[model samples]
Target: MKYLLKGAGLALLLGTTAAYANDGLMAEIAKPEQWAIPTGDYANTRYSTLDQINRDNVKDLRVAWTFSTGVLRGHEGSPLVIGDIMYVHTPFPNNVMALDLNNDGKILWRYEPQQDPNVIAVMCCDTVNRGLSYADGMIILPQADTTVVALDAQTGEVKWSTKIGDPAIGETLTMATMPVKDKVMVGISGGEYGVRGRVTALNLADGSEAWKAYSTGPDDEMLVDPENTMVLGKPIGADSSLNSWEGDQWKIGGGSIWGWFSYDPDLNLMYYGTGNPSTWNPSQRPGDNKWSMTIMARDVDTGMAKWFYQMTPHDEWDYDGVNENILTNQEIDGVERKLLTHFDRNGLAYTMDRETGELLVAEKFDPAVNWTTGVDMDPNSETYGRPAVVAEYSTAQNGEDENTTGICPAALGTKDMQPAAYSPKTNTFYVPTNHVCMDYEPFRVAYTAGQPYVGATLSMYPAPDSHGGMGNFIAWDNVEGKIKWSLPEQFSVWSGALATAGDIVFYGTLEGYLKAIDADSGEELYKFKTPSGIIGNVMTYQHGGKQYIGILSGVGGWAGIGLAAGLTNPNEGLGAVGGYASLSDYTELGGQLTVFELPGEPAAN
Candidate 1:
């Protein structure tokens, strides 16, 4: 079952300890002057240590520079700053631009890949590329056509290009590539198209296959040691996935990995969550649909699963578990634990022991979540760690063609792919959330390659009987499983959040305003309108002794699909268009990066 790389020099490459490469990357991340990775650091904290613009002076922040990607689609991830250069990416065609920071943001080189336009049809949501990765003088770009290309950082010359998946059969790549010690990891998209999802690792030197792990399949194909890989501290045994499905239906079972990934060098394990199962109709695929909506921890060297925990089994609401996993250390009940905190789309915030995969705390982060009463935490109960389903909101219980109404948080959940930020300064997590509800009807459908296999029709709107707002920005205390403060918004905060040592937190709205708030109190400090609505992540870096805050404004994620793709139907975008139809009234289509800084002279290096 060992999947070793094929090339001759791969032995030497694999011989290099992960600690050596991790140490080099860790040193780069230690420097506050550069954003070396997409999620700020491997923990996916999205936090910065810069304090050049403090809360007292943040009101005077102004635009220092702006650059357009010229694609005019949804931008989901932030740019990477390495030394004196910044790497920017675009959607669809997947263009990469390297800007010279020593100059006035002049473009040093650009790499554009020619992809088939038909690939756009298979994409479930808007055509968005999360971002890029840099390692060993190479810039890694995962294209929408399922190609992973490695470019020379300086000249933008193609070093190697590898095809990971086939777009003709409903496979694409949207998540940002992760390059570890000796491999570049990429995940496949298209859960709505009944695509069997997987994660593949390629040799960093020559792009040879290192190992591939499927989400649902035989234990050997999944790289899971049935008796060794623990789930909730219990072994899963054998055929855990095959036994859960009805016959060959598991072949197209969708458990996509199109989300954020985090790694712990000490454990040498990488963590990520899987998406929902295919054919949204719950009755179509019986049993628990094992491993579909689960959080997985795997060894980076061999693609072997160490542990897993299913957050929402046999999902009926399309609530994807593919959100980011934030790794941190905290004390709970007088015990210090290596914790992994995840705010799942199922409307629950989970805190677990990262080493042994033990569930610790599970609580509702949003007040409007009503699909389930809460997660069962009783250790002695047979339903331990499972959600207590409220039959009134169960689409499956209502049966096919019956509209199950008033489901809170909708299918988009409280939060989509837009990530949250953790600030050690306040010991809190700053989350951007959606306040919405939906009515869903499930039906039976036949599966077809490259065509959507979704069998659900839904309509979404703002949550009723509350603030009337569609979104909220809250400060969550994971240790206490409570929200300290919440700020309501007229629209969903579709952008990724950034926490700084300056006691400031930043997030963008679907109305194009990038607002800065007090990290501890959730008080608004400053706000500025960009060219378009923002669905991108916020980033910060220092160059020439000047700190700058940057965000991409394009407005085409699942939250802004009504305007991004010009869909006018209420059932489109999986009910997101109907929920956020008002987004077009505030902003239009555009793609640009707006960077901010305090008005002052640069300090000496």
Candidate 2:
């Protein structure tokens, strides 16, 4: 049953009781029939309720339709299905096309932006757009050249366009925007270029700046109330973020917010995680590097930091804490608790209380993770939840000219930008993971405006004592703190995971195969080869009483950055930074939307 709200009830449900400009328009996003947000819902679960073509019959699924995205460096986002029209976004020039689903997926209209071609060189990874957010009859797009545009949902007309970041300074916008009430929230990416990261809110009525919060800055700029902001049952002291850094380095300190956002309507709060510090050389800026590698909760309307917990204090290996924080209800100690589960790039999966920043369960999802022994979560312990570094693998501790060998789970961390999906039916997190390690050597580098300021040299390969495969797809049981089932892959599982009510989980591999597996047991049910590797998220929608699954296939993200940068191993240990050496040999890059459905015509509604 789809939840449809109207009038005051709709407004109340959205927590927009204070009356914003577009209260009614915002409530339409929660309807089950539409994929309003990039992560499928405000909680960023990526789980769909549609189940007409599930488990038992999923094996009968076949390709229903296919469309090509002309310009593709990396198609890293899923198509947005609203009513009978599906929205698709491509990379580089960032094209938006609407296809009428009821009429054989015909192109209704397409909008292409006049973006500056020079911006492509500044992008840290491949040129990719994370998709769009729909609200107030507009498809909100965050272009690669640091511009945000709102297009008419029906006619594809440009309603408003505003500049959010300056590409000349190495600040680019790649992540999707999150719109709530009258605000369309967007964040910046440029940690690799010494660009200070922040999340800005733009008015939906007109593309005007509403408020901005820097991830690493003074309390006022960060919108942090030192007396009120809580971190581990303690108030954050004055200049906590500032005092953590040395000198004025905090100005260029990198805490990029390039991941997914999740909101809690009842609490009227929004949640997001920040990326790594300015440069990979942690010795440059010391002291926990407050707010750099942290998960922060803030007021949706004003963007004030309520509580923040640093996941990787003084991060050394580029292990960004920018993974998705999935909101859901979980039973802990026989009590139903509102929980947030995050499978971090640091190789630790955390389950915490969403209402208050409290750690509940912290466990390692990957057995090959050797950077940290464990996360010490006892509040009374001096190292509460901090990663106990293995001295040999600590690049920061080793300093310049020193090389650290056999760093398991590599600099890519256990995961990358690819998201994991949660199933309420089974209470399991289907995680796509990278199982590789790297040898690192940190060297000092001078910062220039539009150039890479990274201070590390890295080469990745398969971890020791492991089957030479690069990745794994596993079902994680957060409550029990164990792996329910595991599936190994030859290449990194770079695509997002999708779980359905029909007990079917879907994900794509770097090998260009779209796969459907049993939700209860990790057994492969169906597989279809696509034109290219799959780097996009998987989503399901229903049209004309028939359920269909859609995903974008065009691999060229960080894992495939080797291909995009025209890099090949000149020597045995050089070339790509991460353990993505197998990407070129295993897969090639192209763009296409592959939609699947069970055989048979649509049933009458």
- Per TM-score, the best of the predicted structures is 1
Q: Number of clashes in model 1? A: 0
Error of 1 at 46 (Å): 1.0
Looking at candidate 1, what is the lDDT of residue 202? 94
Worst 10 residues of 2 by lDDT: 1-10
Off-target runs (Cα >4 Å) in candidate 2 are: 1-27, 569-578, 603-605
Report the alpha-carbon TM-score of model 2 versus the true structure.
0.95
lDDT of 1 by residue, 415-466 (tens): 8889999987788899999988999999999998888899999999888998
Please, what is the TM-score per model?
A: 0.96, 0.95
Candidate 1 collision pairs: none
